[model samples]
Target: MNQSHTYDDVPYPDLCYAYTHPGRIAAIATLLGMQPTPVENCRVLELGCAGGGNLIPMAYGLPNSTFTGIDNSARQIEMAQQKATALGLDNITLQTMDIMEVAPDFGEFDYIIVHGIYAWVPPAVQDQLLAICQQNLAPQGVAYISYNTLPGWHMVLMVREMMQYHTRKVTDPRQRADLARTLINDLVQMIPESENSAYAAFLHTYADMRFDKLGGHTDWEDSALLHDELSEYNTPLYFHQFIEHAAQHGLQYLAEADFTQVMMHDLPENTQLRLQEMAHDTIELEQYLDFVRHQTFRRTLLCHESVDVDRTLRAERIRHLYISSRAVLLADNDGNEYFRTHDGSTFPAEHPLTTAALRYLSQISPRAVRFEPLLKQACARLNLAQPTPEDAHMLAINLLQAFTYSLQMAEMMTCSPDFTIEISERPLASPLARLQVQIAPLISNLRHEQVELDGLSRAVTPFLDGQHTLPMLVDELADMVAAGQLAPSKEHATPEQIRKQLDHDIRYALRWLSRAALLIG
Candidate 1:
């Protein structure tokens, strides 16, 4: 089957990737000393943008910015246009276009996204991807590309080989996926874990991971799985080979989109020194790291080869950026407090001012704070007179180290979107999120994070139009239960008890939504 027809037959998942957000792209670009176009007013283009799941939220967040998303699947483009029209979003354009026909003359973009496409396309189309970015990307633009990498894929390819062979005769996509999954689980069950056989261990681990992603149901990501692993054109390349290809097209690697994964902070001192000494350039360093980690997937950022990219992470670079922390402060047995980031890395809360700043970031999290004002507030909290230059450097370096470890976030630009943490008398959420719940439980929040709504929250989201007070919201839920549209938690309850529970649940859902950054003032 042809590529477009395959996608049209089984559409890819409609989901937003936070790391691919222009906000994050610009942030990492700025940290590397490149003058990337600020996301606030930049133009963005997403190739293979399935239904604009990633691009539409961007347009909504950056009202001043313009977006264009093209996919070969007309079905997905139609789906995208429908949602854009429903959202009344005028800044985004979705169209059906073949990858090979996308000429550089189409338009220049400040940021170009080719997510989940490079390795899956034919080699000719992959070369054209680089050609388009080289010719069409703005002078300071960043192009984001994602694909599977080598060494790590060796084992995964083994699994894929087996699955593909087992499902070769199955014509139906969902049935093929089910059969493939059965083969995997069956092998895992048939072979008991043994110290001598690594294959058995790998199968068990892989099966568990699949269960985690698709849940207990074998049919969850039926189309997603069919395209991801069972597709006819899945290819894995080495980081070095991919960069060599990019270099031929006049592009160079800036960094990985997920900076934390490539960091050398966690490496031992001698190991880091050895790797640095073995590699002649940044590209060589990255390739070596890939080999060391046996990396399976990569989300890479690229820029014009002519542009000078400063790889140093200077403290001053963060002075103008916005910072936020989603870490929880924990105390050890000795009462030595440390902050545990969302990803499970722990950093000491040693510096007084730095700790205060992180605490403030946590307090207002999902809401970012500017660097200067944040410093002032931290100093004020510490009851210090003016912050000395040393104090500034100290806080900056500590935060930078933690940021590299993925313990914190710094963004070059952020949008208000008229949302706040405060819950109002008649709470309201972002129109995009409110519209999202009507379709599915996994919705996009203001932060570009995917929020999975619970049953009560999903039921309550559509009603948060800023037109209903607490009593009115409770009445809406009460009426739904009375009309048999919603089921009460208790099988049988008195009317008074149901009313009380409804009031409590509505308030609880609103407060949770407020913290999730879904509420708009």
Candidate 2:
């Protein structure tokens, strides 16, 4: 394979941000109710860890854990290493080695993450990846594997096919993207605008989309169209097929990362009812439905151990409240002036009754206040001094925007002194959720290791502060060993030998700490 073709050629930084944020991972872990053992002690390995964009953030976030990132591209590995060194992060190690070369020696890991690798690679490599996960995943380990799915991609594939035919002679990436866009645009213009013409409507909508200013990157279109149109193994498997394949490898589908996308909720009532009646097992039913939907793009999590995933409790009835800053008008009678919400999204100015509520909230804090107190405060600030039944209803609607933005308090009544807001926790039934569960065991085990290693690393840090020589540290360790604080090692150890030992011990300690999330490098 060409060196460039071996890895994702584009600098997909945004994709990295979207796929691997620590907050999302933490949220998923919390929803699963799985205790992370510690950050300083876990062992994490990432396959296709391109340029360390994803792994570096993780390593930095969880300093106590040990991270190992592998890539076949030497240039990417070198970039990852440079970033690690610049950041002074010692917990992560990057190697320019193929998966096949290191699979055996890699040993079992607590967490194995492979993003944007499975579907893009050849069958042999894909099989090798699965085999590695099967062989080296610890008993409680979870593997996060993302791949392109089907059904959703069917239309996208059609677009790709069209683009490929039009751009067959174009070799340059930018030119190919432009040519594809032009072809799509031309197709759109050919549709006639007429009532009761569904094809015409489709063409018009497609044309509008082609010219839409917000319609994302041209390069993205080129890359996706090229891959979808040309790739030999761009086959999409049903959920059942994927599950069966995983079963053969000693792994079980735990859950999805995004709970909302699970087909159970969105399927037609009749279809759902029929599926429930026909399918015998939970896995079977899910797989059957997935086939029905022709799911494209799977963010599946596989685990070595079976976990019961029914911890999510639904919010039966939520009463929301909101508080916002008073609108600042440029003129006394300005009709268009409004205040921005906490999320930087705008909110239009309301009537005097609503304006009064906002003004009182603004006086207290420019940032929006909670709903419960805002009503009473509005009453006091407006000189009504008492909240009416009518006022309460109006306040509820005014608070709708805040509730939608997730800025309201956890409990409906924000008046209580103890009231603290919490992001509504939903069930983890998506690919993201499944990934969290699958990795839960590994995270816990690694966290434990991280804590132990962190203590050791901290103890040694004082020695490396540059006051003492290598011989002095060795003497101190020897004395401590004699005192039963540490284990005895070689007597008459040279400075270089002692330094080597310290470095090795520190690296090992840091590795475990990185796993635990205590330190990120």
Candidate 3:
């Protein structure tokens, strides 16, 4: 099949990727002491934006930020156009165009995103993609590109070869996916685990990761298999090699899209010291880290070569940014309290002020709190008259240290605490989210985080239009139970008990929606 028609035959998965959000890209840029285009009023472009899953949510969130997307597959572009129209998004434009034919005079963008396209295209197209980024990017702009990386890709390529061999005679995309999945499962069962057999270990690991992704997304499985795993033009390169190509196009490495993966803070101190001594520069250190971690994939951020990127990150820089935390307060076996994130990273909360700030962020998490106000509140808790720069510096150091361990907390340039957290009499979710759940379980909330809906949440999503009060929502749940659409916990429950259970259930479901970034205001 032709590369352009690959998506036309079997569509690629249409879902928001959290890391590719311009909020995140800009935040990373700002942290490096580069002033990125504020996500709110910037020009954004996406190369190979399939169905606008990534761009549409961004357009929804940042109405002032103009968006343009191009995909070689007309079918995918049409899907994007249809959805963009349906959403009433006037700020975005979708076009069906090839990367090679892109004109330098076409325009400049503050942020350019090339996700899930780099490694799958032919080499000429790949070079053109990078060249376009350099040509079209605005001053101080950031570009995100994801690819299959080397040393790690060594093993993944083996599995890909095996799958391709199995499906060699297959022409239909759907049949190719079926064959690939079946082959992997068969190999999993056929391979025996042993200490010496590394292939068996890698195979089992691959199966587990693949199945984990395949769990609830049959659409994703087929799309990914055909376009990603079984594609003809998949290419993998080392980190340094990719940078060398980018350099020729006047683009340089900015950072990794994932904050946690870029740092060596998680490694043992001696190992970190040793690696630092052995490697010549930041790029070499990264290559060594990739080899050590056995990473199979990467989402790299790039910028114009003329831009100055400060590698030395200072704690004081976060004082002017927004802060959010999902840290859970827990106690140790000795009853000593500490903060832990969803990723299971524990950090000490030593200072009373820092502890207060963290607690506030945790209470209203996913809602970004301003640094100054947070510091004032923390000082107020300590009964201090006013917050000082000293207070900010202290807190920034603590938060920065914790953020390095894991992304339990984050610093962003664009998020605001504008939305109300309390469950109002009439709750409302974005029209986009409400529209999405009716079509599929996967939807992007206002924060651009992808949410997989549970049955109860899915039922409650459409009703969150500020039209239904809390009691009215409870009534809907009761109606669902009565109509047999929703199952009761106990078959023989009385009417009074069921009503009470539903009243509680509706509250819990809606509250979950609020926290999941699904409920807008």
Candidate 4:
């Protein structure tokens, strides 16, 4: 089937969003020791912001932050602008502009996010982006950039070569994707299926996976093939190269978003040991190790040269306590448990014992409790006198991983009230739930009073259209209030009273909107 083509120019926003690496933004923020600035007041810009799928979510997430998205494609810019208007998000501005045209009039921004543009764009445009970063990012601001990397994509290149050669005969993007799939499928069928042919089996297995995923969208197939085919620039660079590049424009690589990825802990022990033995400097080790490992992608955060990245104040800015979920099953051993995660998958508890702990967690719903309390309760429920130090540590790590994955996924998906937790508490429920309870009433009061709440409320209102978490709605609302757009209640509204009022207002708002056919169930 010829998938619908909405426009001639490839939509950058949708493509960018599809391949956006997980945890990149949060990692950049953490490395820069930056906090989430008020969306209503902060100036934010995204270069190569495709159709604004990624930018729109961020614009909606932080109403306190003002957003400007620039794209080379006029059609993509139009789509983004149209969506922004349809959503009534006035805080965002979308313009059709090239990176070469970026100027001072765009204004300095507290944060700049650029994805999928660095590798594909020309060297001159890349230089311009760096110039923009140097001239435009706030003193303490952060820039999030994701690019194609080497080593990991080398294998992918072989596949890409085959696809390109095959697709040269095919004109349609969907057809290209299909031909690519067919080529891989035929290769797989030609190979004998046997355990001895593990390498061949892997290729076929990967082919099957790609085939199953083909032809869903034009942006998806085209971008995937394009990125794969044109990835010499996309491969891993020495940390020094990136550092030097940024330095030319007065920016520096602060840190990586997937800290673990940078740590290279996933590599074989012997290889790591050898690399550690050979490498003398941290930068050299990082660069050489990544090359050896064939690392393909990197989410890096950069900051201006004038910033005191080494100061205690800067260190303090790093966010350590994060909210995550238990989404991976760490261990399957009878008494020992272990788990693994890649990108955005949640940590899942392995056994009934851990499952019970999760159950106890749910009962405490919506309150930020101490970790000790949660551990104590889990121990009691499991009939264990106390959790051993190792046991406690294991659980803590797993839970933290889950929360991090959840937060990243939420951010990437552009979902509301981005759920997170203050790790100091072992809350009865998820920290995300507690945040909602604390903020729901504040939102309701502002809405009822027709107060000009901060951008946050507006950011989160769509998600709150009443079916999801009340806490998320409250967080967004509280952000609006914090931005001074919404007024605090004149009447004394206790938390309970606020909840009651919020519930009533939400119900009424939904009913009225539904009755007017302004909202569809």
> What TM-score would candidate 2 get against the native?
0.54
lDDT for every model?
0.84, 0.53, 0.83, 0.54
lDDT of 2 at 147: 77
- Candidate 2 segments whose C-alpha is farther than 4 A from its true place: 1-14, 17-41, 191-233, 263-274, 288-294, 305-521
Candidate 1 C-alpha error for residue 14, in Å: 0.6
Number of backbone collisions per candidate, in order? 0, 56, 0, 51
- Residues 251-301 of candidate 3 have per-residue lDDT tens digits of 999999887898887789998998999899889999999999988899999
Tens digit of per-residue lDDT, candidate 4, span 57-150? 5565456668888876788788778767765788889998778888877798877877766766567877887888888887777777777666
Off by over 4 Å in 4: 1-7, 12-41, 190-202, 205-219, 226-240, 267-272, 310-322, 327-521
- Report model 3's TM-score to 2 decimal places: 0.95
Q: Which stretches of candidate 1 lie over 4 Å from their true place?
A: 1-5, 192-197, 214-220, 407-418
- In lDDT terms, how accurate is model 3? 0.83
